[model samples]
Target: MTSAALPPSASVTVRVPAKINLELLVGPPGADGYHPLATVFHAVNLFDEVTVTAAEEWGLSVSGPQSLGVPVDGTNLAAKAAQALAERAGVDEPVHIAIRKDIPVAGGMAGGSADAAATLVACDHLWGLGTTKQELEEIAGGLGSDVAFLLSGGTAMGSGRGEILAPVLARGTYHWVLALSEGGLSTPAVYAECDRLRGSVAVPDPVPTPEMMQALRSGDARALGAALQNDLQAAALSLMPALTDVIDAGLEFGAVGGIVSGSGPTVAFLCEDTESALDLAVALTASGAVQDVRRATGPAHGAHVIGGPRPG
Candidate 1:
């Protein structure tokens, strides 16, 4: 945002990390059909980078190992983000956005949200709009629940449909083994399934997990692992029962803790250290229960410019 003097033809690139819900507490759906969440969000090494450049007309392209199924049209969240920002800033200049995806698509890891957050940062600098952080947060909150957290990663408390955020003091780095599945899970479908499973049961308000917060503060992986909880887990498992085998494999491999990441087919295993993560990853892969495994470390920084504006 400091590069407001850059030429109109300049381009900017921003890298944003993927998020995992370490503890997702879901409340009854509110009037808006959005669940109230009191959750712990942890940003990990999985990332998606988005670059923006001035163009004669709006355009989008995507590439990367995870790029196969991602949309390249206006329906994409990144595209919607550009349109939103352009309207908000009262600028009509078109931008060509290039997204290099590394985060798993539709894995309940919020990869699409990450791209939208990256687009906001990239377009803000590329356009030399000098938009304030508060304004960006407001825009992000409208884009999606996880978009705001992608803008200010690390550990945070996610409330109000996961849009409102506050930083959490997490003391140490945590290693994770992510078990990826062959197909993605539809987030909406999972939520619908959750409601169906509840079946008129009184789903009360979500509250804090003091033990989880304390474990994070003390940097105790074991305690944190033991405290990992997700209300959507039951629904996720119900929709994709195959995921249970993956979770069991992680625990059997001696992971300190394992849970379905977000609304997941991607199971995240909390390990004691880097070595433990590698070992667990190998074990899960060898078990043939998961399509792939990625070893990642948590508490990564959020989205920001990796490339400053440069003249075309």
Candidate 2:
């Protein structure tokens, strides 16, 4: 007897969360010209949704509030991810990707990386590649340093150019108020500035403080807030002096702690609780220190398929 024909593959959608650095320590540039880093990555609720559908031709489109700056071509990380997966799987099928972004573009939130992570998961499911998580993580690491962490999300420690990952044990959620700048800062530029500012000084090996780890272990938001640190803050502030004003404004509004989010123009203000986050968001918005303010909670899940599969 003949077997029945298999059903067509279904489309897949993956939602990925944005990230903030709880502790970002930057060491000297390596022989590869990339800085060595030891950082704590915390995934927040701000998310980007990536949808993959099999198509006759590979194409990418972006929508949503922060989508204007994203490239729709192969240069886009999401596209690169899909291409990489296809190449790895030896699949010739073309796929169409639609990114619905809420994460700030190039704002040190790893928005692009999030999309790439989501695409990897989505396309893998859509194409029935059955790629293992380890295989997907390897592809993610090749795409970007932050992409690997985005694939896992939650709380993790990153080293070796921020691709090496170790899960962090943390107890409670952390509330934050993000102040979005009018224009995003270029990460490469920020790193260059950091190099320049550290000229003549011996860069030390970057390491996260024990206190930060302890705070997370205890689930003490106040302690965590006090322990928040970013090595790139000085460089970011040097490049965008106005960011200092934003940080000051956040503190003035009773933020427990405020730091430049990675190589950022976006400022993240830590709050004691949800109420404090809301209050800070409102105050920062009213003060006009930032173009926009958003409230989010950290310790969110990584890229994952959302909703049930749909027929092709």
Candidate 3:
């Protein structure tokens, strides 16, 4: 039996979950544009599905509520994944990739990264390339920072521009209330702002705190909430100053802890349990400080096949 999910037919569909950074420590940008990162990534229930079908020419389409402004061309990360896989396998035939997005676009949830990871899995199965997990991760590394984490799912520590991965000892599921924004913040812009805020201060290398690691290991919700940290939080707040009100509302509504999700606009509120998440979601939605409110459980599975591996 193959360890990897197999494609049953001409088309392969894969579902991938969105990711949130539980702890994000970003260092100054090196010679390369990317900032050094030490982050704890947790996949959430929010998902996007990508289906790939063999086609004479390359094509892509995006649908679902958050598909607006998404590129359906080569520029799309999904397309890049497929093309890269094809190049790796020396296959020239093209496959059309269709993405059904439920994850928020550019919402600091790594929606695009999830789609890219799904496409990689789907196309690999479609072509019967027999790509190993390590090989796939190598391809994913170039696609985006969060792409590699989405491929493995669960909880992991990411370094080296968030491409390098190491598993974390996360013990249990975590409840969260996400205050999503209608408009997205550009990650690059947020990084620029972070740099601007730092000004001339010498940036120190980043490391995940032992307290945060201990909380995840112990599966203590309150401890995790208290330990939640994101270096990008201040930058995100600067970009969307109104986000302060959202954070305030989450805490006011009894969230154990609240911080900007990754970049800007979306704020994550940690709750004690599902009951707390439900109440926080309702309160955040009613507060009018956020565009939308979503409750998600974290440590969800990463990209995996949910469709057929039909009899060939």
Candidate 4:
């Protein structure tokens, strides 16, 4: 369905959730240098906000805990998303984008991808493009692999460099304790390390385990925790050994399962319930095993408008 047409002075705001990989099985690198993946993505309550307003020239700004590292120029994914949508809609008028981030930067939580997804939705609404959901998804895929998933947050299976998606049935919420690191891990560097580590070994096709799916369907956190896995964990740990300490600490604090969220640095611990998550967060914070400890629940809704159009 189409939204009401917005005036040239109208603005739109969208909120997008950060994602963690419950399972990230990676195969050998393809000709394109990207490893094939079989992954289950879970969107957490952590979010980044993007607001778009009509402007004379395309401009961008960021403000939040992690904003210092985010680019405000064309290099930013949000700006790229806006340009892509403008080209598709054949509108030359520019937009001003403002971002407020809570998701950790370069923590493998797809924070940039979340902003990109939010920009696409906000701009489409602001410009009254009336783009279909499928159209937006197609655009999202071009922006990045994880961007598509950010467009429809929840539990889902990702394949083909993580762009192709199939929604998985997830029964209930899962509590998580995220241990944020002081520094970010480069995604490309982690992938290269994975390739280097597996130099001669014949890699098998990545596949998701049935046990994990069953646990999700049953809403059993412990079972799901036992099934949590990430092929990139070894490489991530190799690059940043300090993460090992964080993982150990989380488990010691009574986490059922813990894994590097995606590529590196940030570690996510699965807790049995809300109370357990709070306890874990408190312990992790007090122990100083990480830079910061935050609690979140999954699966959260995808990129969605949180502010209505108002006269400029």
lDDT at position 161, candidate 3: 90
lDDT of 3 by residue, 1-312 (tens): 123332333788999998889999999999977799999998999889998887777899999988998998889999999988888878766788999988888899998889999998987777777789999999999899899999999999999999999988889889999888879999999999999999999989998899999999999889999998999999988888888888888999999988787885788888999998998899888878888888899889989988744223
10 residues in a row with least lDDT, candidate 4: 1-10
lDDT (10s digit) by residue, model 1, range 1-312 = 123343456688999999999999999998889899999999998989998988888999999989989999998999999999889998877889999999999998999999999999998878778888889999999999999999989999999989989888889999999999988999999999999999999978999789889999989999999999999999999999999888888999999999998999889999999988888888888889999999999999999899976334
Clash statistics: count for each candidate: 0, 0, 2, 0
Candidate 4 lDDT score at position 79? 95
- In terms of TM-score, how similar is model 1 to the real structure? 0.96
Decoy 4 TM-score against native: 0.96
Query: For candidate 4, what is the lDDT?
Result: 0.91
TM-score of each: 0.96, 0.96, 0.95, 0.96
lDDT of each residue in 1-312, candidate 4, tens digit only: 334444557789999999999999999988878899999999999999999988777899999988869988899999999888878778776789999999999999999999999999998878777788898888999999999999999889999989999988889899999999998999999999998999999999998899889989999899999999999999999999999999999999999999999996899999999999999999999998899988999999999999966333
lDDT measured at residue 293 in model 3 versus the true structure, 0 to 100 = 85
| Candidate 2: tens digits of C-alpha lDDT, residues 1-312 | 111222334468999999999999999998889999999999999999999876767899999999888999999999999999988888777778999999999899999999999999987777766788899989999999999999889999999988899988899988999999988889999999999999989988998899999999999887888999998999999988999899989999999889999999889999999998998988888898799999999889999999546333
Worst 10 residues of 1 by lDDT: 1-10
What does the lDDT read for residue 132 in candidate 3? 91
RMSD (Å) per prediction: 2.3, 2.9, 3.0, 2.4
Which candidate wins on lDDT? 4
TM-score of 3: 0.95
Residue pairs clashing in model 4 are: none
Model 1 regions lying over 4 Å from their true place: 1-9, 310-312
Model 1 residue 299 lDDT score: 91
